[model samples]
Target: MKKLMLMLVSAAALTAHSAMAKDTLTISVYSFAQDAYKKALYDPFEEICDCELVIETGNSVERMAKIEANAADPVIDMAVISSHDALSLAQKGLIAPLDISKLSNHAKLYPAAQDPIGNNMAVGYTFYASSIVYRDDLVKIKSWGDLLGKDLAGQVSLPNITGTQGPLTLMMLDKALNGGSGDFSSVIAKIGEDADDIVTFYSRSSELAQLMNQEEVIAAPLGRFAWSRFKNSPLSFAWAEPEEGQAGGMNVMIMTKGNGNEELAYKLMDYWLSTEVQTRIAEALIDSPANKDVVVSDEVADNLTYGADLINSLNILSPAEIIANRDAWVEQWNAEVIK
Candidate 1:
């Protein structure tokens, strides 16, 4: 009787361990705001799904390279990346089309978020407007053209051509100079012409913020997501409403091609897109909600890229356009601007 009872207990332990292993879900995401995300999104979703989230965090380029390296056997079940990066993955057949039927919150998303990168391969979870953030006390910025103007010349900084905001700044500057010409050769040459007057090409928003705070840079183009850094600063800063308008972009969520974890991944994605979670994230000021149903207070909205009017009014460069012309842009930037 003793031997039989011990055998039963051992088998039960093995079954419990197997269940725990099967319930785990792995994900990759940006390195920023992990603590805020845990409090707002990760912790709540973990409770609802009853699964452990094994998260991998890094820059989009590093994370995307990892996904590509492990394409034969995906380590990340799902990931959040810039829309252009998602499109690049979709083009490479590294990610699978989402089963929208499985997502209960699918209908809650803004139309632009629903099929951002077509074929349901990815869904946008956030949008951010890009514009110039200037020290209003020191100088006035009325146009994207002003960054290269003689007044702000030596005091202005621009994003590097390799960063996400790089192409956006280029697009807006092109609009300001030539009235929305898609070709950027002349734009690149123009920037090259004024490169000597420009302070430096910053790779991260934080670096630009630091430069501004020290009075080294008086004005620079930045994404709204980083507005809080300047908004709370002791220095007087202002967001620009340039004549060319605010340029914007979206970040998206994607499922790996064959991770064998769709059930749990879809569950988390649905919960994330739901109004409750989206509102929580927006309230935390971590990301602007892509779900149209999310409502936030005026104070909270001021810190985010919120509301239909502003979202609709943004001049967004398409993911297709970014991917198609990025190489040429970079090549010219190296030869002319950076040289």
Candidate 2:
């Protein structure tokens, strides 16, 4: 009877441990996250763990908002977010602190993607840089200051103030202000008056390609990923080297608090940052990978910021400052720049 009782206890413990070993996980990713999940994430995980992945895709802001809404109960397991949004979620304690040591692949990531800001609340997974794309045939724009004058005046594309493009444009404008030193009130006011000169205030980077192909708009301040289509065209991107240089944001991955899948989340992140997976994702035209150990060929590496040196050189705004002053910046943009 004693032996039987001990055997029963061991059996129960084993069952419990097996139940807890489930590798299947659900991920909340941005809509744009599909390509990466397909090329870099899903198959490798599925092959190794034989576990299914359920993807929940939405905008970064909306995804973070959902995490916030479910903070008390915790519906999400893991998510990808922009660096600023990741910081915001961490500040609010909506995300779980990552157990960095568990992630052996942690040592393989590019330094820029290594949670320089969030500690372990978030980790950089990709690098994206923004610059001006122009038709070499139409305009001769070489500097950010050139944007203000008459060279490509009527055939331009810019982001509308109420959209994501609005913030991106502000970052560029701030740079154009000669590291925030150039007097830009007149330039800002002129944009509002000259709004018509802008062919469209695009909400999506994909639209820039359409407008460019149609010749309705020749130049735009575009994200690196958006340049995939234009890479071989007479239309190409230039750094535009505003006196302050270019500013960029790192895409981040965060584990949601209390979803009962910490290990699975870490494993998914490890897979995503695996050098092989990172190379594949960058090649598939998804965003750049976060793994510094991954070496990319000239093609995938051309337009993206993937390596350590480039990632470190990327000038990004502070999350606290960007979030705190966003409203004021928008207000100033509308009052001074947008009119």
TM-score (all chains, Cα) for each model? 0.92, 0.80
Which regions of candidate 2 are displaced past 4 Å? 1-24, 33-36, 160-168, 182-190, 232-244, 333-339
**Candidate 2 structure quality by residue, lDDT tens digits, 162-271:** 44445556666756644664343444565777676778777656666778888888777766655666776654534354455566777788888888988878888877
lDDT of 1 by residue, 47-78 (tens): 88778999898766789999999999999999
Model 2's TM-score against the true structure? 0.80
Q: Which candidate number maximizes lDDT? A: 1
Candidate 2 residue 161 C-alpha distance from true site, Å: 5.0
Q: How many clashing pairs does model 1 include?
A: 0
How many pairs of residues collide in each model?
Answer: 0, 3
In terms of lDDT, the poorest run of 10 residues in model 1 is 15-24
